[model samples]
Target chain A: MKRITHFYSLTPEWQHSFAKEMGGELIDNKIIVIPEDIGHGYSYFTQVTPGISVLYVDFVLDTPIKITRQKSDNELYIFHFDMSEHVNLIRINKIDYRIGTHEDLGLAIIDNKMKSTFKPAVGDRTLAVRLLVDKKLLDEFIKTHPSEEHGNRKISVPKKSLYYYDHIDSHSMLLIRSIKDRSVFDSSFESYLKGISLRLLGNFLDRYEHSQAVKDEITDVEIESVTKTQTYLLDNLYNPFPSVPFLSKMAGMSPSKYKMIFKKQFHNTPKNLFIEEKMILANRLLQSGDYKTLTEVIYELNYSKLSYFCSKYYELFHRKPADDLVKKKYNQKCITKSTLQ
Target chain B: MKIIEHSFGPDLDWLPHYAEQLGGKIDGNFIIAPDNGIRYILPCGEGISAFYVDVTYNSDFHKIQKNRDTDFIGLYYNLTDGEATLTARDFMYNVSRWHYNLSVIDGLINTDYVVKSGSRTYGLAIFIKKSIIESYAKKENIVINQIEEITNPEKNTIIRFDRMSYDSYYILEELHKQKVGGPIFDFNLAGTVHLLISNYLRKLSTNKIILQTVNQTDLNNIILIQKYLIEHAEETFPSIKQMADMANMSESKFKILFRKITGSTPNVFFMENKLIKAKELLEEKQYSISQISDKFHFTNNSYFTSKFKEYYGLSPKIFIKHL
Candidate 1:
């Protein structure tokens, strides 16, 4: 294992130091392509706007590499997105944290004062996007756009070093995916990236404000329970929604406490999440075209009564199952017709 | 008809001007529409501004005249059902629905258009400083023909009349579906506008699209054919020979002119509008799939399903999931 240490910053000096440590050469004054001996891919850095910069690193390591950033006095917030093909691992102030599996992707925000180390799971592609933003700028934005939780109150950042990590909401995730999927059109790529960066910053500030308003400290044990409950719900989506009491008992917590913690952690009610997932699954099944009739789909998912299933599906997806079936068949027919022609 | 004159540019200060004219109040970056719809004005950057409006006028017709003091390049996207006539000086064009709807014009002079009411008017306008675009073009070593023409500054020369490609359409859809509020909403709107501008620039970079000014009479004929098709969307599509005869032109000439103006064949245009109309009926929830197919004069339900799926990427039955 090779370990590299550097003082924290998103400037040329810091980028050069990291590049040198990784035995790579800096190119175009903005990118450092990884040396073939160590990995494939490159790290790109850009100043989106004043007070906000983005550093995107993507590579697969032939050997394990750990990058450590020494604690600094700069008041900055690092919004890190780990989009690796597998689980992404990191340590903040000697506390270990693991995340970024496809099903469990999230954003991790760390205060600049805390020493942090990134230990990506190797032999697989490691993709990460980090936005370095000035704390003062973030505070200014929060003052103008107060979260619902902290309505009309003058919110301030506490003196304690902040380290918060949570699942990226679907909306934010969609924005991130759009950014990733964009092809570089040279003329306006910078402006395009800057626009996406602002969007991400805006979303983060809102989330941070809401997080600051919550006074209760969530424990590791509680997080574990909530995570386990989420996995259980996702796995049993085909089955009817397990009652709150049933889930709470499994999590070894009171029913009301469980519900509160679930909402706080996932930002969704248990029943709503279950229904949403069930509908999503139903959509996939209906699109698969293996099932000829909507009734077969309803029965396959343990649903009874075509009308009841249609209403629930409509409530969640706003479209009927029958339409999806016809859509599937129609698409197949078009494919055949085109080929024949 | 009501006349509403307005100007939009780099700053959002023009929002107040619009609010005062519309009898609405300005709320931060939004114009709280008095009753009909939503309006967002976003200042994207130093020399870029974007505006989005989705409203149905209480009046039957409104003629909006845009008069700008400064020279700016305006990228306008008209997404409403075809109910608009864009008049840039003497060159007049009817707004095509979705397809071939992007119009880029130099806003050096006064230009006005008429928008009919009773249906929603959804559109986005992006204003960019002409100097900024010139500097960008020079720095990037790319020359857009229309940009150079701006050196002499033709009064109302349209830079390009093109279709919104699939990518642009997807971005527009995302913009329409945006649900965030507050500063995030502002950022999302601005970011999306930049994306649209970026897409427009990318298309221009290829230098394939050029200034296309059609004859007024020819444009009028195309508009007439389009309106006729839209009106009879429920009926069977007229043959190209019949349409050509109706337009008083040869079949090949009529086909070429229609494809050039609309970016689609006549049959495709008719069927697309028909499917869209069928989608609206589906939203009404008054008819079953069979009933809609029968009403549309399709041979059978499966054929209707295939056509709907081909055009919408989802069968009418399943596409309702979004409604």
Candidate 2:
């Protein structure tokens, strides 16, 4: 395993050091495409605004590597979105945290005072983005959007570090996907990246503030159980919905209590979330073009009745399975026509 | 005409005060007009602000002018069903339906526009500071000297109008679908604005169409005719002789310049708009295929179906199913 040292500040020294350690050449002082021997993507870093900076990572490592950064005096809030196929393991101030790969929880926010080491899983692709924000600006932003119980719920950043592990909500995920789809070859790529970076930062701050206001209602132990149960449900999407009593037993609580806590955390009842995930999976299977027929898709997703499946799919996506099939066939025809042309 | 003047800048404090005069009240980041429409102001960051308005007035012919001193770029998108004319510097533009609806205007030049009452007008204005645009351009190694020259306050302002691409249209549709005051509404609004601005910039960088300096009077006349065509899309396209007389030009000259300015023949443009309107009606789910076909004056249902499929790559029924 190769150990790489890097820093988060937007300075030439930091860029040069990281590029040198990775044996990659820097381009235009902002991007460094990792050497082919180690990875196949680039790391882009830039200051989006005066008090906000972003570091975008999209690469797949062939060899094991660990990125270690020293503690910094520059007080900044780092919002990290580990959007990878596999989980990212990080150690911050001697506490190990596994981030990403769970739909319900993936993003992590940490203070710059804590030293960290990021170990990305090899072979699987790694996609992560980090926003470094000035503490003073964030503090001012918090003061403006004061919650109802702002007096006691205030997260005054004195000297102690703040760490928040949260879920990358569906909206943020869509924004992330949009950012990923942007082409670097475009002449106006930098401007587009900066604009989206500002949006992602704004979104993170809003979520952070809302989470702070609601922090007093839930206990840590309860949160742990809810997270465990949610992950379980997400992992078992192809299976039929587990009964309420069964899920509550897994979370070690009464069925009603489990349902309430699950709703509070995930913003949906457990059964609804399961069905939604299943429908999403079903849609993907239909669109993937691997299945031969609609019956195959239904069977793959463990659906008992075609009519029931179609109604649930419509309820979720506002389109029926037959519609998707028509679109797929139409798209295939267009592809063939273009190829012939 | 009721004349209203507004100062354009990053600060949106004047909006709520101005909305009050029009029988509206501020609700958080939104200005609510009980009978008119609602407007949202989202300040993304230091130098970026998004303003969205969907309003119609009881009174007729209100002329609004935006007053500004500093230079900036205003990315304006109009998705309206109304008659409006905008005059930015010397060039006049008709806010026509469907086609060429995105306007990239220079903020240094004052913009004046008049909107007819009783018709809904939906618009989004994203105000971006020139300094910020300069920084992005400089860092990206894109020489925007041409942009600077075109947007010079002292020179005659030349606004760039583009047909909003299908992708951008879908993005705006998604943004419009978002409910206000959700836990993540502000973030979503900012995100959508970011995508819109980025998409516009991408188009700006890759633009290849030469902006010919058409004669001002001829351009205005063409715009007027285009507006007429859009307003009467359901009706048959007028003959070339009548259209040429309307534009005060000979038929040969009319055919050449119409294609040059709008990138389509007059009849093609008319039919394109009719099909677009037909698609919208189909999405509304209020009319069937035969009704829409008859409404658009198509010969029959099969003809309408073929034309729709040829234009949009799917029959009306399938499009409805997909929707």
| Root-mean-square deviation (CA) per prediction | 19.1, 20.7
Model 1 has a DockQ score of 0.14
- Please name the candidate that would achieve the greatest TM-score relative to the true structure: 1
lDDT against the true structure, each candidate: 0.72, 0.73
- lDDT at residue B4 of model 2 (Cα atoms): 62
Q: Give one digit per residue, the lDDT tens place, for model 1 in A35-119.
A: 8987787777777656678876777888788888887777778888776657877787567777673536457787878888888
lDDT of 2 by residue, A1-341 (tens): 99998777744358888899889989888888899999788878877766678888888899999999776888787888877856888887677788874434578777777888999889887888888888887777677776764455424534444456766754456456666666565545665667667667656666566554443255566779889988898898877788889999998889999999989988999999899988888888888877778888888878879999999999999998977862335467788889999
Per-residue accuracy of model 2 over B242-302 as CA lDDT, tens digit each: 9899999999988887877666789988888898788878756666788899999999999
For candidate 1, lDDT tens digit of each residue in B68-149?
A: 5456888888787747767765567666453347877677656676777665677788888888788877867775655546
Q: Model 2: runs farther than 4 Å from truth?
A: A10-13, A93-95, A102-104, A136-162, A202-341, B6-49, B64-70, B88-92, B96-99, B108-110, B129-156, B173-191, B207-323
Where is model 1 more than 4 Å wrong at Cα? A7-29, A137-162, A179-185, A201-341, B13-15, B32-36, B60-71, B146-158, B179-181, B206-323
Return the top candidate by lDDT: 2
Residue pairs of candidate 2 with colliding backbone atoms: none
Instruction: Give the share of true interchain contacts found in each model.
Output: 0.35, 0.26
Cα-based lDDT at residue B7, candidate 2: 66
